[model samples]
Target: MLAKRINGALRHVPAWPLYIVAVVPPVWLLWQGLTGGLGVEPIKALEHELGELALQLLIAGLCITPLRRFAGVNLLRYRRAVGLIAFFYVVLHLLVWLVLDVQILSQIWADIIKRPYITVGMAAFVLLIPLAATSNNASIRKLGGKRWRQLHKLVYAAALLGGVHFLMLVKGFQIEPLIYLAIIVGLLALRLPLATGARQRA
Candidate 1:
């Protein structure tokens, strides 16, 4: 029964073309920016693009469980890649701020300490580093499944921090950040003890 279940899940997941779908948006954004068609402030455009990518990846990471359980696609295999992409764009977003806006390490550090948004964003990025580093089959085997799962739970917190950072960075409340916050909330809700307990008994 277990073997058949796993096979059924595998059969439901679409082919590898789905990976390309994930890569296309960033590529198109870069192409648009390079062609001088993004917007008046290209740096701002780049920053927003990278930030959006980070948020999208966070949402995609959260969707894995629902896709697996609801659609029976077992999309957990893509979660690590989605998480690493989140970290990658987060690094780019930080670099844009450091290089284009702040221009000095001392100033950047000062802003992180003084500005709540910067602090939260920095905290999220910092948490992502270890998760990204250890996101591999080999690392999972080394850490054992239980410890690995516990450590990776930090993603939920990191996603929250990312949402808060974006919310505070905006001049006022906006739809984009609100959407991200809602998605994060929903995803985290799905991971609550109640749902997990049900899954365990299933």
Candidate 2:
């Protein structure tokens, strides 16, 4: 089967290399922004680019389980790397908004409170903090497997908020964000039966 072949090939691929490869996109994006390749509004373009990458990575993280359950492709080992990279992009997105886009320190909190999209984005970012902090093996051992799994479930909420944040932040009715939201929702739906099965087993 194709999946078996792919899985067989994946066995030789180390997850660590993904971390090294992940550095390329942000570096390229920053280079483009600096070179004015991002267009007239370079800062805004860079901010949006980082934010979109973050959302894409979040959606990728959500896809891992469904891909394994339905498609017979195991990415369990890469999930942590996927998640941490997503969180990395999320932090980069927030920093670009803070340091480059909005330099005013006082307005950061004000924007979070006043702007609906920013509020949603901040909420999603905050939820990821604990998950990112505990993505390590030591944290897993310390927290216990069950508790660690529970804590990581926060990604679902964060993913939902991330989709909504993108949807709301866009200037008008945009198909891209809507597509992203739909994919996120569909991925979440795929996990429902798995959760139910686990509950039944318990």
lDDT tens digits, residue span 1-202, model 2: 9889989999988899889988999999999999989998899999999999999999999998878877899988899999999999999889999999999999998999999989999999999999999999999999999999889999999999999999997886789999999999988887786653665532
| Ten-residue region with minimum lDDT total, candidate 1 | 11-20
* Stretches > 4 Å off in candidate 1: 1-28, 197-202
TM-score of 1: 0.84
Local error of candidate 2 at residue 59 (angstroms):
0.6
Best by lDDT: 2
lDDT of 1 by residue, 131-179 (tens): 9999888999999988998899898899999998888888855798888
Q: Give the lDDT of residue 63 in candidate 2.
A: 90
Q: Model 2 misses residue 123 by how many Å?
A: 0.4
In angstroms, give how far residue 92 of model 2 lies from its true place: 0.8
CA shift at 52, candidate 2, in angstroms? Answer: 0.5
